[model samples]
Target: MDRSTGSGLSFAKRIYLPRSIGLGIGFMCVAAGLWPLQPQPWVWALLVFNGFLWPHLAYLLARMSKAPFKSERRNLLIDSVFGGFWAAAMQFNALPTVTILAMMAMNNIAAGGGRFFFKGCLSMLLGMLLGLLTFGPAFNPETSMLQLYACLPMLVLYPLALGWVSYRLSIKLAEHKQALRAVSRTDSLTRLYNHGHWKDLLHREFDKCRQGQHRATVALIDVDHFKAINDGHGHLVGDSVLRLLSERLALSLREDDLAGRYGGDEFCVILPNTPAVLAADVMERLRQELAEVRSELAPHLQITLSIGLAGYSPMQLDANHWLKDADQALYQAKRQGRNQVVSAAD
Candidate 1:
């Protein structure tokens, strides 16, 4: 499912398009229905041509173009051009009471759906106030200020209701986007990061450490005699042991530390702003704690770990090279003894 990196509009935008178009169309349809009450035939024709048909056509053109919505510059251009054409269509004909109100409502709905809430609300209010000026005269050429007071209640309620609905929709969309991101980055088991998530974090942290000359460490921890445990006991106990081991690792590390399941029976920890010596000490303490827990939980089988530590240094090497050295040290620790800590050369 992976495509080119930085390739297109973020997934959130992709999901939002259909919802936005549906709302736009719904608002336009509402406007078209109200047209029969308007006194101007030209205004009804304009509403039919622009609010419903023309905007939908523009939306289709953009979809067919396949331009990513993430490009803000291009997106702005498209919105401006299409919006100008829409406004021109509305302004070309003489509008009436019902047509004006419908146009204002449709504009409010479209603007609120897209990221222009304040502008939409202000415009809706202004449009209604202007309706008082135009429609009031139609009823009576010398209509008093008292006459306009009757319409004020309905005018206020209209914008408030639309704003509330728009706000609710926006919040729901945001929650959906957040849930998608969590599912993409998180592992179901152990509740820690998966391989892909860990890799991205590693690269990001490495860049920060390199640029800032900030000390950081990577620790590779392998559960010793893991294959034997799986062979002697069933896979279920093996899985529990792995989860228990990770729980201990999570408890021992700092709040800023990133712990991930590298693969079966192996885990990696990224400790930001911690030097190699301190990272090694931390992992050693964790190893001792893990051994104690294993003794209490699974006395029938023994479990211990070997840890390899490597520090980040911009002057010495890049992120990949540092990780390679740490992995090599991990192999060395496994060769030297089952449960020990090994530090890589700077």
Candidate 2:
């Protein structure tokens, strides 16, 4: 559905249970306050309906509305109206009136912040006017022990329910943020680390190497005649080749190894705690495996990789120098022969 409708549905679902619980328990508090006034039978009936039945009806109204979020907001206002009516009906008894109005205000603030809270207050004022007209204005500030006891459940349980809903919302937001971070750092085509994130890791690895804390090797790999393949077979076939290479890299590399798409047809890898000699052997195996593979999309097309390796050296002035060494080695591999692995240290 559209954004507005999706938000409305989510808002409705979040509010429904808390509304049900609050109203059900609130019935006792209102009833206890009204009991001293000897309210008419119709008033009692109205109280019962508002306390027990209105929550479900409100939920149905919101769910069925074309504008559910707006409908739900209207429902909240009605709840505030009812709260005001009950407070006035109780002759503004200190405990029950405060409990009812406080709960309604809490809900309003939580739902829509300060602006909605003020709207709810206006609605409550309108309700108070209605109650004044119906019951005739009077004030009874005293609260019986029974009324105080009746207010306890709503005061305690409603906040807890609202707190739980807020907590769940916070957790879901955190998970979404983490997922977005991962997506931002990942290449869409190959599901490998994108160029920027890989370079970031390279910088960190370079720092470790410079500090003499670790040894690492960097490799740059380029697809052989990738432009020709793309021109002959189409970009779709070229994509399949890249995806296939990435899958093999993921499967072949150690868990600590980092691989990323450097750009168009070039990929980069960082092998931590490895020497150039060992890295060359690893790349040679990878190169051979890729050369033997054929793409399902272009079965007649053969794929090969030219790889260059550079082991960390204390003499390197910066990460860029180390990367330049690998790039030079990659150029050397391409010049010597398209399918071979060459090491800068060699």
Query: Which candidate should be chosen as best, given lDDT against the real structure?
Result: 2
For model 1, state the Cα shift of residue 72 in Å. Answer: 35
RMSD score of candidate 1 (Å): 12.1
TM-scores, all candidates, are 0.57, 0.95
lDDT of 2 by residue, 215-270 (tens): 99999999999999999999999999999999999988999999999999999999
Cα lDDT for residue 141, candidate 2: 86
Determine which window of 10 residues in candidate 2 has minimal summed lDDT: 1-10
Error of 1 at 178 (Å): 2.4
RMSD of each: 12.1, 1.6
Q: In model 2, which runs have C-alpha deviations exceeding 4 angstroms?
A: 1-3
Sum up the clashes in candidate 1.
Answer: 0
Q: For candidate 1, what is the lDDT? A: 0.62
